[model samples]
Target chain A: MFRPFLLACAMLTVSNLTRPGLQPVSFAVEAGKALAIVGPSGAGKSLLLRAIADLDPNDGDVSIDGIERRSVPAPRWRQMAGLLPAETGWWADTVGAHFTSGKPDEASLGQLGLPGDALDWQVARLSTGERQRLGLLRMLMVQPSVLLLDEPTASLDEQSSAQVEQLLGDRLAAGNTIVFASHDERQVARLAYAVMSIRDGVAEPPEAVP
Target chain B: MSQYIALSYWDVVLAAVFLAINGGLSLWLDLRLEKQLLIASVRMVVQLLLIGIILKWVFAATSPTITAAMAAIMAVFAAREIWARQERRLTGVWGYGVGGGAMVFAGVLVTVLALTTQVQPDPWWSPRYALPLFGMILGNTMTGISLGLDTLNATVHRERVAIEAQLCLGATKWQSMAPFARRALRSGFMPIINAMAATGVVSLPGMMTGQILSGVDPEEAVKYQLLVMFLIGGATGLGVLLAVGGGVWRLSDERHRLRLDRLQQTR
Candidate 1:
């Protein structure tokens, strides 16, 4: 049984590199744990996430729970390994239309510290903070196995930032793996169970903490 | 018929006035291009006069072959304009594809009307009926195709990440670029929509005025205008949709990622 599994794994590794730059970079994201990536800008932190989520061109290896990322179809990969970019895109006219699954109702809005009637609010009227909060909430609603966030709270105020951290903490406690990129050392210290600092496209060894 | 001639002359004079106004404004905006404008006006007058003389003979001869040849010539001119507007050295393959595709698509539709509906005096090619109709369709399709290609290329460059995201999500190459493709197609057809809306109000259309000038009854001229408009709408719509859609397919690779660098270099 183990022999067949190993062969299957080898085959997956080969197929993942079919596109020149589509292979996932090797980084194990444990279930129920949060891994924060700290790096200078343009260090390929966001690109790494994109690659794992099959959103960027790459060549290497990537797997979720030993299942090769490339073996899974892209839609399934996106649904399973969701990436929340620094600036989330809202395609619909109203806030309510952004959510595909859950109702964008008063309770959900209130949870995100938004006005109850935000569901009816036009996207143009929303501030950057509001848009970011809505983007986070939209990602949460998807209930993916892994969450890849690219500086999700870089733009929010301290109070709003703390709220977002708390929300992520709650989700972490409930057993979801998150890999987020940030340059903020304080945010990294607060949220990271393990920190991987990336430099010039290379992921450095994780620092051990007492 | 006498009344129609009077109306045609009146319409032509109004068109000339409008052209003069536009020309004056253009001159005011850029005095440097005055020479260019003069040259363009001269070319237009000479070309139209030549076409008029040739068409007079075509109408007198009333041969289907000559009529078809004239239609083909119009298509060639339109195709050349499309190529020049793109500013790309379309390899022979692309040239054949764009030129033949646009011509056949527009040609078949126009042929059906001219042959079946008896729009012209002759069964196959009535220069009076076919030439003008062909010119309108060819001109519109040329603009549409150029706009479609330009919009498609621009969208691909701007929305690379979104397209990649969609592609990674199991969208085929066509599926990945579908949004941009749709946008291009929309831009291509927008002018046609504007023309349709502006018809008979902002401008008196060319065919109606011409028919009225050349001794056709006002009511009869109006009918022809309506028929031509509908035909144009149908022919151009089909031609542009196919041209843009087919062009997009040719632009990408088997992987579905747009060849951005290649397209950029060409531009």
Candidate 2:
């Protein structure tokens, strides 16, 4: 098993980011590990991810590496816990414009199978898979300790999906935590060390992968 | 010097004939706007006549309290107009307060500045000068503010996801919203910019035209019109800037979170 041993600690912790009358969701992801949240459509999977990112208003405590999310300023907290929505929004005219930290790393772009001139491409012309990959790359540039991704590879084909998985594997290998929601069985089997199933806001406590 | 032409009530009735022709055309085209035209004409007549009577009383009274009260009332109505103009308003008091407060603040501040510094009426609050100047500024500022608020809220709603994405990328609320604020300000300022550009060439400004019609010296009227235009421009710019800022403030929370839930669509 590939496990990063740099900093052994609970990198991402969620102590009930759920509403009343619903089962409270509580889980912890150790450094360099990935947790997959799987459930049917409209099962509040995205909502849970948003809650953990503190993107939405919700009850419960979310912390990173022993520091409560509220302790740090929101922008800093968001930087540490970067979120990639299923459909990322591109407001600027060019892809490079969306990247705030100048041009993104060319190596990361190449690893994602994006062309060398992809950053110069107009956002209106990018394919769905390209957008998703760019969104991931954009989030990665921030170098968040925890990556909150919603369907990170849903828009990609088998080859592109594998490339993304490989890139994410490298991130995990570097001791970054990942909490992602996926519907793909293969993705869950391949990436996650733990699996959490949520249905209609009720979440089962995470179980270890066999 | 040409004498100011005083039109009798019968002459005013003759002027209504032009509106009657407009109503006739609306009926012919099945525009279904004849009723609206009639009601609007009647309302305009009543409103203007009432204002005329009130102005006569106010000018005769020559009291600072009366002039200030009339200015306050005009400002309040302008605020109400701004509130009524938004399609999607900030959920509560913020909807009225943000734009309304901007206009009243800008309008009064600019008018007082002009009166005390430039226009310099005997008491500075003289109704003749203060009322007209304040009314013009309030009207222009109202348009600018309402347009700004509308553009800000609409763009924010349309680009909610994009803004959230920026926020997710660790952008502070102001940073995430800077572009939208710029767009809103442009929308707010465009009207005055166009008006200023086209004032003499494309259209005669109402105040200057009224002054000329009342037989004021052309050069003197031009100076007054110039002063009025400059004052309106300053007030509109300040009003729009403040309203847009307040709008951005209302739409977000202290944690730099974008709170789209703060908006309510009125349709």
Candidate 3:
């Protein structure tokens, strides 16, 4: 019954996120800004991302624009503020089944380096890189206000990775806020407007991208 | 129908011969189940004899309290059996309550309907008809709930990410879990469907066979069996529905976040 106004300038916000093995972490990214989270494996980058998305249980306040996470339901919040997990899960047999609108945009599919006929292919036959790319495409199809991407290009080859970065840049320019976790600092240097580094239970306040 | 010949004590021994032969095969094949077979055989006789004595007393007395108590006790056992079979369950007595309550609800509904309608025995609560009918319905319904719950748990565990993705897509909790719930219900109902399909072809069902052996008219026996099967079908549908429903409810928090932690992993 509670319909929110269409969020323009998706201002990503997080406060006091406390989950197991992670300290209470907080940060905010201005609208259209990309915040890169860099940490070693097992450093709780994924946990923090999940917490911010309200996927896992954590004590935190996460909001997009002025709308609080608790104000809307978790399902609605996650839909408006989407999280692409490290290893994406596919439940349906074909690529088309994942999308609610029946078919993913063929042009966007090409942008993510997927063939136009990719939607017709069985999900089981997808290579890890293909799945990863399609997973991002699937998340992007919803056009969430905020995006939590866990290594969006971790499985992509260099050429495909460039395509993804360009696609994400296009989305961010369209006013999406992003928090992505990766060990790739060069990528951070390339795309991030701010950076949050985690090491041994320590999290830095958001710093301007160096 | 002609009068049925009663089985003698020697006839009981003739039944035991099958058990003896099974034990002998275990011994010869080194399957190492001789002690287990021997103990099961002994336990069977003891348990059946004890139950028989109790049932005899129950039938003679015909007290509603005692009848209800017996059914409740059986229901409790069936519920506990369902709880034990589930690898993941709601913590504490909730699992027991969900499983037991579903079976009891379905059983009572079916039983009361049958008694007031098709099966109006002389005393209304005739142990001869009520006990067996209730037992059969409860047993089958309990099996269905157990299967339904197990499938629900496994699906929730296996498809957590996919479900969460759906939630991320603005789907309601029910929308996210509806497909899995349907699958679990199918798992639960498949056995009953198979039995229905195989009835009279694969094998004569138990109630019909027993009634025929007891010198009931074949037509009368078949009719009773058919009615019981229909009642069993309704009871099973309710059982699986409630079990899967309760399971999915406990799976997620009110915030619509998946609370997998609420389910204890028995594996």
Candidate 4:
């Protein structure tokens, strides 16, 4: 019985590695928890998340709750397992228009420490920090089951960064799986429940301490 | 009428001065080589002299077939220029497809629907009737196609992310590129809109001036100019709309994903 179980796990591992550009890099995250990825630039941290989100064309197997990510239609997968890159693009003229979900609630904006009237402002008028905050708000409005953030707070000041961390913590408590990439060790110490370092294209062992 | 005749010499001088100014500006801008300018000047003298001689024969013969042949030649020349101005080398298939499609569709629609149905000319394709009409339509179509292609290419380059993001968001290739399609079509038609606004009072259009110079009645010239304006406007609008709308769809794959690599390779 032990031998059969080991054989089944090996077969599953082999099958996962066969995906294009996707090697079997193993990491696990519990539902409603946050996993922080720390790596040097060009270490494939963003690529890993992109593969899981199926944004980068890749062959390896990735799943959300045992459902293969590729098996889902692209739009449906994006709706559920969204990746937010460092520089979020805004296509609409006004900040309020970016949200397909109704205008972002004042409470949510206030939690991010953004002005309540921010939704009415034109995207061109917003500062870089404001854009980042709005980008984060837009992603949360989607109500994604899995959130992949690539340097989400890289542009924010300490105060705004703390506000973002608090908001993310709230989301985690509410049961959303988060996989975030950051080069900042401080951010990892503050928000990461589990920290994994990526070097080259491979994932390193999770270090118990941030 | 006597006063107008007396001012004909001044008109000739004004036209010569305008041509000199255009030539000087072209030289200043380095848009013309000395050799090319020499060739162009020689060609202009030869071609216009030959046309002057031929016009006497055309007027004498009044042959509709000869007029039709001239119109066809003008369309072919305009099509060649349109094909050359596109930055990417379109497959011969697409060039011929867009060129022949615009010429035939616009040509037939304007000539039949607007011109013949409205004017009831003595011989529908008379040199006086067909040649100028064909020239105006073909010129506008060439301008429209050039603008459409340039605008489409620029939009693809500038808004690549928005396009890709839309595609990743579940938009089929065509749906993803809808913004570019709209921009290109709008750019292609903008000149037509501006020309329509500036017609008559702001500008004494070429055909109207030519008719007046050729001793036609002023009232008759105005009527023909009005008809030609509507015909060219309709032809250009249709040609641009069809060319841009059809051209954008071809830039994508069967999956509706834009084959950007293919476009970049050509560039």
Better of 1 and 2 by TM-score: 2
As a TM-score, model 2 comes out at 0.94
Error of 1 at A7 (Å): 25
- Residues B1-267 of candidate 3: C-alpha lDDT, one tens digit per residue: 576878898999998898899889999999999999888888998999999999999998899999989888888889899998888887777778877888899999999889878899977778877899999999999889999988988889889988887776667788888999999999999988988899999989999998899899999999999999999999999888988888888888777777788778775
RMSD of 2: 2.7
* lDDT per residue as tens, model 1, B1-267: 555333365676677776677678878887566677778977997898798789889889887787788777777677777666664433456744763486468757765665567564545455665676677767777787777766776676667655554443344668667777899889888888898899999988888888778888878978878887777777777777887776677666543444554443463
CAPRI class assigned to model 4: incorrect
Decide which is better by DockQ, 3 or 4.
3
Cα lDDT tens digits for candidate 1, A1-210: 001111111111112322332222445655667788888888778767766665544566666666766576656666566678776665457888766646555665676678777778898788989888988777666666677889989889988888888878866666667889987888888888788787777676566422
Candidate number of the best DockQ = 2
Ranked candidates (lDDT, high to low): 2, 3, 4, 1
> Relative to the unseen true structure, what is the C-alpha lDDT of residue B20 in candidate 4, on a scale of 0 to 100?
71
Docking class of 2: medium
The local lDDT score (0 to 100) that residue A100 gets in candidate 4 is 64
Cα error, candidate 3, residue A148 (Å):
0.8
Model 1 RMSD in angstroms: 7.0
> Which candidate number maximizes lDDT?
2
Docking level of model 1: incorrect
Q: Against the unseen true structure, what C-alpha lDDT does each candidate score?
A: 0.68, 0.89, 0.85, 0.70
DockQ of each: 0.15, 0.71, 0.61, 0.17
Choose 1 or 4, whichever is better by TM-score.
1
Q: What interface RMSD do all candidates show, one decimal each? A: 4.1, 0.9, 1.5, 3.4
Which digits, one per residue and each the tens of the lDDT, describe model 4 over residues B155-228?
77667666655544445667667778888888888887888789786998887887788777889988988778
For model 3, residues A1-210, the per-residue Cα lDDT tens digits are 112226647997788878887899888898888999988888888888888877777887877887898898777788778889888877789988888734565687878778889989999999999988888877766668898999999988899989989978877777778899988888998889899888876788888987
What are the TM-scores, per candidate, against the unseen true structure?
0.71, 0.94, 0.94, 0.69
